[model samples]
Target chain A: MHREDFPMLKKDIIYFDNGATTLKPQCVIDSVVEYMTNHTSNIHRGDYDAAVITNKLYDNVRNIVSSFVNCDSREVIYTSGATQSLNMVVFGYMKKHLKKGDEVLLNKAEHASNILPWIILSKQIGIVIKYVPLDNNYELTLENIKRCVTFKTKVISLAQITNVIGDVRDVYNIGKFCHENNILFNVDGAQSVPHMRVDFKNCYMDFLSFSGHKMCGPTGVGILVGRYELLEDMDPLCYGGGMNSYFEENGDYELKSIPTRFEAGTTPIAQVIGLGEAIKYLMKIGMDNIHEHEMKLKQYLLDKVKDIPNIIVYNTSSNSGIFAFNIDGVFAQDTSIYLNSYNIYVRAGNHCAKELKDEINIKNTVRVSMYFYNNYNDVDRLVDALRNSKDIFKIVL
Target chain B: MDNDLRREIIMDNYNDPMNKGLIDDNSYLKTRTSSESCIDDLSFMMKIENNIIEDIRFDGEACAISTSATSIMIRILIGKTVDEAKKILNNYKNMIEEKDYDKNLLGELAVYDSISKQPNRKNCALLPNRAINNMLEELNKKNN
Candidate 1:
């Protein structure tokens, strides 16, 4: 499995919290270290050899990102993280174009970043917010989307794969529907881009956002891929030295072109280069192979944990490598703490998708997310830890 | 459990928690507190008459350590005057933090003798006691 690539795995623990952030490989680390050690100069500013090399490596990440998502390099916008990317779209595009009485459609399964920005905008302007209905399993179906759409529906924003529930959403079909109906479509690709292959043109997405850290890249680097025509129409969220073409004393300034204008201050040069290396590493392994490995692990884990006596599984139909569940009488946090004592790490709480609390009818649950590095032995260790936890909880109660 | 402190007294209180319910009376002083890192949501209510804590109750969703700590705390607080309650609270905090304190004075709270070793659970064990300390301050202000 590519477990040896991550140095932190030497510590005795079964890491099942990959949905929060992934462990970076040695090649990605080396890329960042190489840049910092040798070519530690500003890009696009100096005429020296170091600066030229820096600029080339920095600009090359755009091509890497574009090819990773199957979009043109000019459409790839560098950002601090997915949060910043989503905010740019919210403040830069939606705030300007979406008017009062217009509607924005979302669902309960979306991450907080996707929903909160729209909520703030809806309150600021008198824009109405609506939700796509869900079935018994809290899944957003295509029929539900059609049923929820209104004449005033102007935008549809959702996650490619929800973090908590781990359901693989058919965003491509949804994007096609949005195009035919003349509505803007935005995809939160933070969870999906790291796990599976995503094609920008095939999905017909107007805008997509994702973080690099969740895909074995550095923490501060991410990408926002937008159609060139739409990106040209939107304004920049920040103004600074690098993004400007010319300036006058009377506050008059000519700004740079689309992607450059959107990236305001000093960019994350080392992290972006590291992300380019990460994208190459992922492509070399093949996204299909990674996806298949993850599914096998997921199936193995589910089959083993399903018959556990007091375990209550919340997401039975999830296609992704995330499992959300809890023991009958034990609190989610307590269970996670118990497992932690056995050198197993998992996430507990509402998992930042607090809006889904009422729908799921539980305030908290434990989440175990897996990645390509995780294998069946890790699953066995977790199952054994969970089984032993019951005996300990009896006395600790 | 590997640790005796987690096994014996903490577990005893968690399994059969005392003073856990809602007091609907208007005379009770009520407050709520929660921790962000874990599920430690709690609601506290105390009935104080004549500067004495006649009754105290807690109700919430929390982990074993937090729930058990609050349960053990309410048992030690009932029927004690505000001043005595404050003294016990300080002593119990000292005991859990492994500072020198009169072990006999802490009573059932001395069960947390080895809590200092588990640094992360210190907040879990002290949250409700801290809430009660706040309640005591509010009562003192009212009396003043």
Candidate 2:
């Protein structure tokens, strides 16, 4: 497919940093601009024709996301981003159920967004934070999780696919185990939801969170999917104008129904509407085809870089669209600088998971993440650049 | 003459860095600074004798720009008084910020003038100066 469909890719730039955020298609951008220019109105409040159209569009986006994830429309709660969605689950669920002396199980490979919030909550509530260690291949195993879980384990928060390494975990089995033990399961789907097929119903997950921007949608929008009954019992993260129904001088106040009850204050209406268009674009392309296209490019790059002496590739088993590696005897930032000279964009450093870096025994690595828009030609260009980098810069590698 | 000399200066210093290591514990004030965002670390040691900078040394893992910048900076600061060293550091910072820099005052440091063109690498080139300024701040705190 021609990249002209995405206006941002026309800048003579090779974009491989899709893990950070993907470039939005023209359709998604046009949807957002069209909404902002023409049908912009405050949803769920105003009574004019504009408000009616806005409400329908906003709620329709929710329905699109619900079908995308195979969940109920009422189960999806919109937030600022995945970070807020994660914090909502950690704080909202922990406040309702967990107490001092409870333990929340986590994996060593979790991003800071997934781990730090739970750590802060544990400190505040006096709950213990435990970790399930990754195997030698950087895969989280059921045996390791079973070993980590204790009788006091109240919650298990883990990434469905590690953001940096892109290793997929068996969240289905993990969720089943958590449910059997009466422990709440929270899956960080920020990386997985964009690249793979996620069925919340089949996975039996208690809570799953993902961001829109990573899926070729607009930023400032995310979805937290959970069971409707559970969401009804949990308190909203924020309380303000949109979430509450009736307020009085007394401390007691009545809150709105599910979804709206969880979403407080003003929403990212334009971005959400654009995200709905993004979903439609992805659906038209089909997730399975997108996944296959990225995997083929990833494998091609992996094969080409495998024989390059002194190059250490992280996560050889990752079928997802991310390649993390480092040139031996060269700082990752230096290598990234060399790549940037050729207009090839890649991410370097710890990738927001300092704990994962420690677990992997590397301070930082260069990451070349791919999207459906990327192809084998991009991979070959990266390889050619890598081969010529030392000779071009006259820097001994 | 200006552009060629600038590149030459930076390359020369990067190839052969001077005063690159730690000093004895009692010899001078020392501080360790690092860029966690980029994972760069440097340990800087300065030896002061009677209010004069007798010597300066740095040892750490960093990009070429930072390593070379430290090498050239120590060469300029050595044998200068404390106030003079501070002035030179300020001038070099201004040079990296694309200010009107004096070539005669910069000496070998003139080679780094082109670094201003690459704004992101400016932090790497200025790492040593940041440590020096931070060290001066600590010394001032002690004196006050």
Please provide, for model 2 over A238-313, each residue's C-alpha lDDT reduced to its tens digit, 9 standing for 90 to 100. Answer: 8898999989998888999988998888899998998899888988888888888888988898889876777789
> DockQ, in order, for the candidates?
0.49, 0.41
* Candidate 1 per-residue C-alpha lDDT over A24-108 given as tens digits, one digit per residue, 9 for 90 to 100: 9999999999999999988678999999999998999899988889999999999988988999998899999999999999988
Query: Where does candidate 1 chain A have its weakest 10-residue lDDT segment?
Result: A388-397
DockQ, model 1, C-alpha based: 0.49
Clashes of 1: 1
Error of 2 at B24 (Å): 11
Off by over 4 Å in 2: A392-397, B1-61, B74-80, B104-107
- Local distance difference test values of all predictions, in order: 0.87, 0.84
Q: What share of the true interface contacts does candidate 2 keep?
A: 0.44
Candidate 1 deviant stretches above 4 angstroms:
A394-397, B1-8, B19-32, B45-57, B133-144
| Model 1 CA lDDT for position A334 | 83
